[model samples]
Target: MSSLAKQLTGVVANTRKLLDLCGSLQAENDMLKLEVQSLKVAVDTSIDKNKQLEEKVKALTVARSLDEVEVGEAGINEKILDTKQKINDFVREIDKCIELLK
Candidate 1:
């Protein structure tokens, strides 16, 4: 073969290799773009879930505080008064029984 023909053949081979490399790079880029889009959606979903959890926690905290306040303010005082009345009634009954025995 002529020297020029040999050089042309080498150039064609290099061009084909470069074209293959470009095709491979393009495919990889497209795959990466899809992966990025999927990750973004996942992140958005996670953010929404976090917001919902935070709201639930806030509601629960408010409910717990209200429950604590109710117990502190009324429940204990009522129990104590009820117990005092019962004890007074029991003492009166015992006194009546003693008089009857005498």
Candidate 2:
């Protein structure tokens, strides 16, 4: 065989090998992307659960504060005002979170 023909054959073989390697890398990349997507889903689910827990905690805290106000004998009218203020603050915080999510 001619030297030029032999060189061309080597080049073609190398190209095929490179293509095969690229195909393999592409498949691996796709798999990694799928895994990342799954992880993101799980993370989002966890975040939602955390938000629910936080809401529950906030409710419990408000209930506890009301109970304290009752037992402390500070007066019902004052307790109502405090509760209203806390509720307003909570609403503002929720609005901030909504804006951030948007």
RMSD of each: 21.6, 2.4
Model 2: worst 10 consecutive residues (lDDT sum): 68-77
Error at 68, model 2, angstroms: 2.7
Per-residue lDDT over 20-94 for candidate 2, one digit per residue giving the tens place of the 0 to 100 score: 999999999999999999999999999999999998998898898788775444577788888899899999998
Best by lDDT: 2
Which lDDT tens digits does candidate 1 get at residues 1-102?
699999999999999999999999999999999999999999999998997897577556545554555356577676566556655765886698799999
TM-score of each prediction = 0.65, 0.78
Top-TM-score structure, candidate number: 2
How big is the positional error of residue 19 in model 1, measured in Å on the Cα after superposition? 0.6
Off by over 4 Å in 2: 71-73, 97-102
Q: How displaced is residue 87 in candidate 1, in Å?
A: 44
Clashes of 2: 0
